[model samples]
Target: MKYFRANRPLTINEVQKFAPAAFADKASLDVSKNYSFLSTRNLIETLEKKNIVPFAVAQTKSRTDEAKESGRHLIRFRHENHKLEIGEVVPEIVLETSHDAKSSFKFSLGLFRLICENGLVAPCSILDTIRIKHVKADDSDVIDAAFEVLDSSDSAIENILEMKRKVLSIDDRFSFANEATTLRWEKESDCPHLPLEKILAPRRRKESELDLWTTFNVVQENLVRGGLSFYKLNDKGYPIARQSTRAVNSIAKNLELNRNLWTLANKFLNN
Candidate 1:
């Protein structure tokens, strides 16, 4: 619940100090120099306005306290200059149809990390989740691999590998997210070649185009009319099922991990 923003470049140790649950392999790489936290609420709102459906796992206050009190579940995300860092949350990755296996999904929701302080979410490419050590954000470069495009006819593995090489060669920065893996990109080099800039940039302008009042009204109507269902994880890390007619709750359910943590942090800070 405590939203942590980086006042300065955060070392792994520093992040661990605030949220001990952060990934384990903090020693190998200097993640402290990069990445920041983001408000999950603001992040989801931004995504929804852009019409991007991001699938995420919900954590409650229990998880929140576990992270803040002992830094046991801390995860980090790296981003550039506070742009929309977390990529499109892939909804296809289903961990379970039932509730018991939810934690599996929690770990699979891409490696995107939230910078608690400024609400700046970033890719958690460089940090190792199990060992919690830092690795090359772009292992595609170091490891020489290819990524499978969600849907592409010409997207062969070889092509993906080549693209990966080129991207990592340029943008040395690595991004981490939820899915036990890393995504590497070389910004300047990759963008011009494939319009990555246009594709990657968050539709910030598109969000601004919508009149806030109108958007909220529409969202409100959907909440009121729609059969809304969600799993509300409280500070104790317990799932609470309820119905709501609030767009905000939708945002909360979608990006619940960040929301629950942020909620707990706010509660702790206020109390």
Candidate 2:
């Protein structure tokens, strides 16, 4: 059975302590007889700790008109820093009532943001409200709808880049801005040849079915031709940055490099 993402699974320790016995004992008070009594209290305490307490009691749900008027809604999860993490992927709230009007369906809904980009920093840039929803029946259908919602929200990605800029600035690094995106001095220093401006430019279209392997080969070819060392050395490292950094640098190294990736990227973009 599929469990809700909002509700994570119980830990091993939790399961071991609260597990019930198969049969009841005859002589003394059966520990298994009151299994629900022991488990229910523990479950409630665990949920409270995680801030995932049920929204309403069993058979008691609120059905308000405000829940019906839906478009985009933010679902916030309390984080470690006394902060609430709003999912960058936005979700819509829907309320469905039963024919008898005795039951209601309410869930925070949105698409998962599955961004594939050349840079770790760029993909991690997303920050805002994130919504968690379970696929009631058709998982693939729900995923498709989520992608559609992610494709629609340009502001969400913009906000992520903006947050990244502020973080860089606080570290006393000089930041170079191009419209909505920024690059820090440290990132620029290591790869001074990179054209910082164009790389961070938000894509004209959000979703692309580009094969990353093909893109990597294209980038490797470009790097080989451009004379930039594909391998960089760290304190105790050998090419720790991996392909993502290689691709980002390959595109940002020169205008001609970007053109090459774009020229190759078009092959996948078209399909």
Candidate 3:
């Protein structure tokens, strides 16, 4: 995906005109009544007025050959520091298809962690998200709702920082690995489960830092990106070495892993 830094807010028409290839496929005239289009241009203007400058935009289609209505655009903003680190805030506005009704449009919030650049959807438990049902809301309402969430990012940053400050012991790390393994392989009876030792293996020497933040990333990398090894039967009926694939491939899985991992880490602090 090509990302362009926005110096000023651009309207949907301007975005389409500027990047015809990305937004070339226009929505059909009969697009679903439930779907409503948010004013990207107005959103940008609102963000800029609040000193929230958009730094990047990504356009993607839900599937190949799908109409433009199925396409989504991601707008990203750096909360304060451009540097990536734990507790640093990166907010993203996703304009995409609505779940309430097919053929309608909605905008959702996503967050990015600097440590691993992991993108997290804003959990309803944490952040207030705006859902604009075309039937009930107008463009101004969408803009107002989006600003409400963006303005409350300070609280979100505080939550992230609190998590980062809590340290994890060596035993806690191992326990986390075991719990993560259970979460990853609870359904796969045929697959050989990875051992806790292997899950705790560090990809880099620096990753051995004894903290909940680093430990979570180390284990998460191994589970989601696949760096560990396991055995499988070959055609000759002999055990052969096989590399593990991503444990979480879909968005739902990603969200589950992130939420569960954080919840697990939070337990240590609570205790």
In angstroms, the error of model 1 at 71 is 8.1
lDDT of 1: 0.25
Superpose all Cα atoms of candidate 2 onto the true structure and report the RMSD in Å to 1 decimal: 20.2
lDDT of each: 0.25, 0.27, 0.57
Better of 1 and 2 by TM-score: 1
**Residue-by-residue lDDT tens digits, candidate 3, 137-225:** 56688667666666666665666666678787778888888877766666666446467878888777766777776676677767776
User: Model 3, stretches more than 4 Å misplaced?
Assistant: 1-31, 40-45, 48-69, 79-116, 120-125, 128-130, 181-186, 190-192, 233-238, 247-256
| Models sorted by lDDT, best on top | 3, 2, 1
- Model 1: per-residue Cα lDDT at residue 208: 24
Error of 3 at 73 (Å): 4.8
The best-first sequence of candidates by TM-score reads 3, 1, 2
Error of 3 at 33 (Å): 3.3
So what's the TM-score on candidate 2? 0.20
Clashes of each: 59, 6, 3
Better of 1 and 3 by lDDT: 3
Model 2, span 1-271: residue lDDT tens: 0111222333434322322110111212222332221112333344346443321111112254322221111121111122223323322211111112122112222222223212111121222222223213222333333334335336434433433333222112112222111122234345533333223223334322123322222233333233333345466655554222332322123223322333333333233
